[model samples]
Target: MVSAARTATETRTTTRTEARRAPDIVAGVADADKLTDEIAATSVDPRLWTGAFATNVWGGRFAIDGVLGEGAQGTTFQGTDLKTGGRVAVKVFDVGRAKDWKALQLFDREADTLKSVDHPGIPKLLDVIVDQETGARALVRTLVPGESLAAEVKSRGPLSEAALWSVIVDVTDVLGALHGRSSPIVHRDLKPANLIRRPDGKVCLVDFGGVGRMRESAGSTVVGTFGYMAPEQLYGAQTPATDMYAFGATLLTLATAKEPEELPRQGLSIDVEAAAAKLSPQLRALLTKLTAPDPSGRPADAKALLAELHAIADAKDRPAAEPSWPEPMVDSPFAARGTDGDFLVGIVGVVFGVLGVVGAIIVGQLLIPLVLTIIAATADGAQKERILAARARVVEAAKVAQRSFERSAQHGARKLESASERERDRAEHRRRRKRELKRHWKDEERRLKQLAKDAKRSARRDGRFWV
Candidate 1:
């Protein structure tokens, strides 16, 4: 009995010690919740941590690896969905406790949005997990395998106008699709960093943590990248025009290697023509109009902006042989809900009429095409590596934009065909009606002539009788 009791005590003590020795693991989170008693640095995404990673939310045992990238809104970690073993990008608002449950709700809402959406460029939504105990929530999505636009800009340097336009068009299509919905979705934030270009040359939008609800009946939060944000967005008004403004700004940034808002304005207001004089003047005018401080001055929604992009594409290139694939931004569909924290980052779509110029990069006294560097290379390794990357991205983005423009044209062609068919039917019906009317008028004229002839004959006969 004594020996058995000693063995039991020893086993119990070993069990407790082992439990204490295990590392703390927080799942469904990528950052330390300031609200929690314990705060930690975000060295790596918690989701990517397979060996042992923990958040305030939950703990899990997993086998995965790789760190994709990080952003202000959320850090994206490369990992696998525990169930299916599929590679995925886990985005979580692990920082700052609850923040009024907005983070969790956004995660839930984005998941619902992802489920309803399907597109190649838009990452596929595999699963949404909410920790029962910790209340931590996350969106499980297919990993976009490529460098971000920011990475491209950073490593490659400023892209060319053509390339910049391509990326803009690609993201614009994604945004256009989202905003094209009946209620419309405004990508509150649109920056090169938020965009990713795949090896296949496809561009996609990532990070929906800042996404807010834009009801036809209500308002939305003003959230987006600083340099790329529209004036209205910066002022707290969310609208599709605001996004256009940001798009223009992004283009300008790539062109000039300067922020849109920082451009030397003609006095207080920006002279779109002057701000982007380095680009095609027409492009400069369009961008200026888009970045107009007043919401009234811009295109009403993403589709119209798409139309303008098509126009640009048309003037620049010819049509493609086949239809292009669709790239959805902020994928998923769900019912709209509330909270001051229920942030639909952009406004619901609206009807609009309109468009930005690429900025010119100034390289000190000697204006060399370089500045944004990727991976920071040793001096003289390859002179102007950053410049090369920028040039490459610009070329690729232009091709992409050109392709998206062609795709839109394809849609337009279908619409045009429908309209032309209707017109032809109307014209044929009008022609038949005209023929019937003409035939009836001729018959009446012939009858009237015969009557006149008879009257004259009777008059002659009467005259002869009188004589």
Candidate 2:
């Protein structure tokens, strides 16, 4: 009996020990399962965890819906504000998975930049959060509505000139706003994928992940896509013109219905002019200059580019000036001739009437002189000398009157000739002006017709059904 009791006591002691260790084993198993889950989450694509993250509350208010997109930096989700029921875009930056320290800095830079910007084209930063459990960061912003410009171009082919112009103007205006800021911001990645075309036909810039301050020093890592990036950008040298280069490449793709990388090239530069040959010369030139391999060759800034675009649009809309001709001077042949004729006739008539009176007087005086001469012949030597002198003086006075009348008639004729010559010259000038104006009008008409024909050809080439 004593031996049985000892074995039983040992058995009881073992059972109590096993019972005490059960809770510890259970706790250890639970910890191992959690460690395994964490390892799986980090090892696989971050996208796989999107569903779990979407369900989680961000910034204690935003409820993520679904994955919108994923990029090298992070994953974006369509989300909702539980407080206001408004839509938002939640960008989660898993810093743990970042390739480099610069990526994390850029992600933080984008958040900081968005928080201060208040433009309509830019999404407003709503909230920022750091997932306590996973150490992931999230940025909540206003949901920008629209597909990417890249997708739109892919589905719709090349945009019409007007449509393309709208897109360019909208984007340029946005850039103007950004670059005009106190501390100008450069959108280093100004590609089609970063541009959002809203339903209202306005374009908004999204994904500011590649944005940087103009005054900031070049980053250690380049932060733009390959084909759209400027040469300087490849070396991490970014400026407003850097954005212009990307803008040019984006527009070139839209204008030609081809990807920037897929388009033909001329050495290191893109042959955009060749691809967009059917576009207007002004547009072609603008794109060419914007995409110039050298940054200096591009526009100085977005504002300058916007001005040039406005000028081009203004030129396109301005009506061509029609050839104008000076009104022809109406000359009445009878009136012109009659004016001179009447004056000449009046002067000649008055002169002739005066001359007739003078002649009569002279004749009368001659008769007197003749009578005097006769008297002289009958009288003595002294009376005959005086009568002969009086006759000679009367003859000389008659000769003077005839000379005066000839001089007056010649003056009147000269004046009439000068007036007629002036009228002739004026008439010739009017005829010449009329001929020149007609020629100019014909030339203008031909130019307009050629412009119309070229426009038609361009429309056909661009695959536009409506001109």
Name the candidate that leads on TM-score: 2
Residue runs of model 1 more than 4 Å from their true location after superposition: 1-62, 69-74, 81-86, 215-222, 234-236, 267-269, 313-467
lDDT per residue as tens, model 2, 49-142:
4323433455556765445777777867675777667889988787777878888888888888886665678887776777565567777888
lDDT for 21 in candidate 2 is: 15
Among these predictions, the greatest lDDT belongs to 2
Q: Which stretches of candidate 2 lie over 4 Å from their true place?
A: 1-55, 215-219, 317-319, 322-467
Q: What's the distance in Å from true for residue 312, model 1? A: 3.5
State the lDDT at 50 in candidate 2: 32
* Tens-digit lDDT string for candidate 1 (1-467): 99999999999865654343212434433442332212224433233222223432222423224345566545555665555455677765453454555556666666766655444567756555555433444556778878887778777777777786777667776776567677666667777777789998878987766665553223444467766766666545666776677676777767666666688676534666766676886577677777776767877777887677655654443214212212222222221112111122111110010000111112221122233344334345466665666656765554555455455445545544544453344345445646876996799688668856864574464332221
